[model samples]
Target: MSRVPRIRFKGFEEDWEQRKLGELADIIGGGTPSTLNLEYWDGNIDWYSPAEIIDQIYVDRSQRKITELGFENSSAKMLPEGTVLFTSRAGIGKTAILAKKGCTNQGFQSIVPYSNKLDSYFIFSRTEELKKYGELVGAGSTFAEVSGRQMGNMQLMIPKTIGEQHIIGVLFSTFDRLITLHQRKLEKLKTIKKSMLENFFPQNGEKTPKIRFSGFIEDWEQRKLGEIVKEVNRVDENSNAPVMMITANDGFIEQSERYSTDNAGKSLKKYILLKRWELAYNHGASKIRPFGSCFALTRAANIRIPFVYHCFLALEDNPEFLEHTLNGKNVENQLRKIVSSGARMDGLLNISFQEYTSIFIRCPIRKEQDKIAILIKSLDHLITLHQSKLEKLQKIKKSMLESMFV
Candidate 1:
């Protein structure tokens, strides 16, 4: 790729100059206010630690607060607005610029740029670029850490004029805004789905939900899950079907798609074929209730009729209702009860098909189930789209960071 000439202001050569961070800026470390002294802790000042740097945006507020006494007691000092706060340990290398005056804990090293020599925004971006270098230097250690002195000692190339620095900062800031917008949309979509689930599903024995499809008056029936879906646990060794792996997130997916294998072996048992709209669940994975983990099949797969996948969804009288309920806190509590063991590290939990089938649920009519599923699925699709856009924006920023600086 052809390299663009270093940017510059009028009458300047535009050639980049190399300087140690210490020469261009003052690097300071943050201290923690005493937690024991209530007066020294929750005051007006925003207190930051490495934990607050995950989003990579300029931080206007912190997750914590400290008082003047707390600030004075610790090794940390207050950094002025526009100082760059970089994580030194625990999620090492993430960096953000402070949008308001605040103090941080020992896990961060704040950079304050010298007057007129470099724009704070430009230094923020450059510090981000330097973070990759810090990681390389800090490699082979269990906890990646770089002191304020180390950050100051690192050498960097920069345009001599502040005007050019501000321009580059503005270009990247636009991309950051686009990314943050998509992230907010994704959060909204999830909230909508949660609210709809609570509204549509019958709560604690009210004959009908206050919110339901218009004109549907038939009372939902309470039925055992086993009565609705068959449970197929037969594993035939001779079957040529694809091997499946189940995870908490995606539910069931082809094992081959998730892993690279030089050795492929055929399973002896054939799985019952599954069709679209069928529900599946895993007995092993439970977020709310240990009864089963469930999902509606979006694709056809040759599997069992009582596939753990569908059976997982078959709870809650309606599969759609069950899907949303599974993610709720109540369901999680029930799941904990159904599972035989609390040892997650063992990767084993006992939930019998018989017990699962007998679980009571308030079932809506099939038509209502279809409607609820469609609405929730549509929201899920929107969430997925926004998440994909966010990922793309992040990737674009990553590429630019790699190419724009030396």
Candidate 2:
């Protein structure tokens, strides 16, 4: 079917044209200088490898530079500022527009657009789909790759007028910037939370935190974890219960996707039911966290977690405080102290309920603990809000890509 975009900018009434990429642009290939030659290694020109082309939308700088002598000796050619750099081998499908002149290894097949008929950003926006096509026609024994001849013959559907292409490119670029902004904000918030967690809690030998909130001047009390909470060992075959798994970094998340159906058969009885205000800990050792991770459930009463996780409820201490305290660096250090030398093949800690309860942890009074948890939780909420916005923008961009191009 011959068609145009579902959505178009005002005054763009003409239908888009379908043309082979080779007819619309000049295709260029790249190569590397001899590694054995020390003189050919480093100089003033930007040199990129397939590994260096990652999630970046545009690339201006490279990790390594090549000398003019090296460039003359190698098969690599200098691509212009607006050239679209696409990896055709090894790490296939990765693409970026050059913000400045650069050269890449033989792994890339770049495109230099004919500006009179094509817009660079417009070509850049289509690189993702082009990557899909490249993958389809690609062939290899060691790794899949699209040849330069294959890439040139690939077809592209684009607006007939350069003005329309420019408009569409700008619109998608704006959305990309918004997503990048939100992602940066989310990362900043997480870094702040990590910093605060370290500083808000006292060190191993200290009686008080380095930074304290106003009106909380007294030193924190040293309390055995056993003195604060008792392990809850309860389970039932309530098939209606929501199934969840405790992740080392992401906390509790639904594991329903792992199951074939909602009716999990006899396996449902093996699951542990957790009530509201309870704590769940992944007692398994992981590469990221040797002692595992723990978090308290703030959701309503019907959540069911796997039996692999150790469940506990606060009896004397504040539940919210215990959750954050255990996740903090000071308490994590305490956990590291008590872990048994022998870990199970499945990675579960050999430390039993008795050993976990006997571990000592430092804590502030209930009033101060509550205040700190509230402050940190508020920051978490803000981070979540921005993350959601970023996800939404990315989804919109995906939809636009589907409808705006043939």
Candidate 3:
């Protein structure tokens, strides 16, 4: 009996036949040219590594190129365009079709599809299934690895007609293109925000910013952080507030969202309670926010965070402006300068509330601050919207991949 996919395109109602991968494509092993040979380096051939196979549907070029001598001298064979480059070791099962002719390092067990039977992208779209299979069957004490023989021997259900394979491949290719487009837009927005953060505020010696709101001619006033904000010393003895945590992305999120349940057990009463529009600084450094991050409670009711976080309320300064400003590079620079590398308290910063309050910051008048805050907030909202859409599209693509292929 033949197997049929759970979901099918219009006018495609044929049962798919089970076939070994070798029947559809020739599985080929790859090799790397020695780095010591100067003559073998930097020629016309594109040489790829397992690391290069990330998230790309098709690879046209490589970071490293090799000479024809390198290809001939090493076990690496010149693969034709439209071959599916599949990594088989260290990080096995990453797949990308060759948009141009290429050869990979020893880590790859690439596939050269037989034009009469297989489509390069048709195999590429089955990446998740292939990865799962590789993981299940791979063997090694050091790192799980699947050999070319194992890859070729693996069985798959494929459309009997080559036209059906092309349609499925095209559908996924379109989805990937859309995802890439949205991802680029998102990155562009982030870059714009970074530029704004860099130029919108005054530098160390400068009194005014490089960029400013129209009609704001006055120099931004310099003030100590203590003058604009005060630490929230109130504790949630009643524990009525929802426990929250400051995240690098997504700002303030409830405790349940971070950990399936409210992991704040016995120390619930010690949690800090923060009202809406108030700010909290988590002095825990991460790669995303190296000097830690501060966020204003723009949404949600009064919430409790761990006592380790420094919670504060903005005085004359707008909470929105202060949130972005403190999280900006200017404040982060001051933070980096002050952080004592030798002293650390449980992987969190050992700096005190008093020290944080003493940090100096330059700010424009309240009106200008409000305007800049509005723009940044708008950008953040747009970013969030696009991110949500991208995530939804990815989920849809994942669902389709599972349903449309074996």
lDDT of 3 by residue, 78-177 (tens): 8999998888887888888888888888898888999989988888888877888887778644678888888999899999999999999999889999
User: Clash number for every model?
Assistant: 26, 0, 0
Give the per-residue lDDT of model 2 (tens digit) for 1-406: 7668887778988888888998888888899999889888779999999898888889999998999999999999999999999999866788888999999999988989998888888988887788888888885445788888888999888888999989898998898788888888999999998888878888767999888999998988888887778787688874576788777766777876555435556666777888888898888877777787788888667677777677888986778778887776666677788886857987788777677777677888889998888988899899889988888898999999888987
Ranking by lDDT: 3, 2, 1
Point to the candidate with the largest TM-score: 3
lDDT (10s digit) by residue, model 1, range 38-65: 9887678898888778766788888778
Model 1 residue runs over 4 Å out of place are 1-17, 32-52, 62-78, 89-91, 105-107, 126-129, 132-145, 159-164, 232-244, 261-264, 268-272, 286-292, 301-335, 342-348
The models' CA-based lDDT, in order, is 0.69, 0.83, 0.86
Give stretches of model 2 more than 4 Å off.
36-41, 141-143, 235-243, 257-263, 267-271, 285-287, 329-351
Q: Residue 163 error for model 2, in Å?
A: 2.2
Local error of candidate 3 at residue 192 (angstroms)? 0.5
